[model samples]
Target: LGITFDNKLHLSGHINNITYKAFRTLNAIKRKFRHQDNDTFLTLYKAKIRPTLQCASPVWTPHLKNQ
Candidate 1:
């Protein structure tokens, strides 16, 4: 669950399995890393595929704010 920023039209995808196991894992991570920094991800599914489908991000990003 990191950050992402992209704008294009190519292929498409789907999240066919939004199961409780996923939620439990995410919740566990959130709790475990509660005392850490604000912008952190305990586990990322894909290090390269995540950043290809996002728009408004941290809002504090300098370049994104300019747009």
Candidate 2:
């Protein structure tokens, strides 16, 4: 959950957690729409996962190597 440490920015753990959560949400959506086609899942992914992962990007993103 940490984005900065000692003036350094790290994303390994943060991205991992985000991916996990997004996957879980996607799975739930899939279960809810088990009979839906790929298009439906794709749309749901864009609507749900995209926003959750992109939230507060400026705060978590690193602008420089030294961060």
Candidate 3:
């Protein structure tokens, strides 16, 4: 699993890691598909960026309000 934990066993590190990866993928898609139409961009986003953000979600998902 790609999930990570801190000394306190918090999922913050895993969340941050996935967030960074997702944003980076989004930026890349924006740059590479600048001329693409809305439908095409949506497709790309769903196929690429969404997966990065959603991967291992059940394992790292926050249950506490402060998390």
Q: For each candidate, what is the lDDT?
A: 0.37, 0.74, 0.86
Q: Give candidate 3's whole-model lDDT.
A: 0.86
Local lDDT at 62 for model 1: 37
Colliding pairs, model 1: none
Could you report the Cα RMSD, in angstroms, for every candidate shown? 10.6, 4.6, 1.6
The most accurate candidate by lDDT is 3
Native-vs-model 2 lDDT?
A: 0.74
Pull out the clashing pairs in model 2: none
Better by TM-score, candidate 3 or 1: 3
Worst 10 residues of 2 by lDDT: 1-10
Candidate 3, which ten residues in sequence have the lowest lDDT sum? 58-67
Tens digits of per-residue lDDT, candidate 1, 1-67, equal: 4332345521111121223335555666667667765445623423222332222224323343323
What is the clash count for each candidate, in the order shown? 0, 0, 0
Top-TM-score structure, candidate number: 3
Task: Give Cα distance to truth, residue 1, candidate 1, Å.
Answer: 26
True lDDT of residue 51, candidate 2: 86
Model 2 quality (TM-score): 0.62
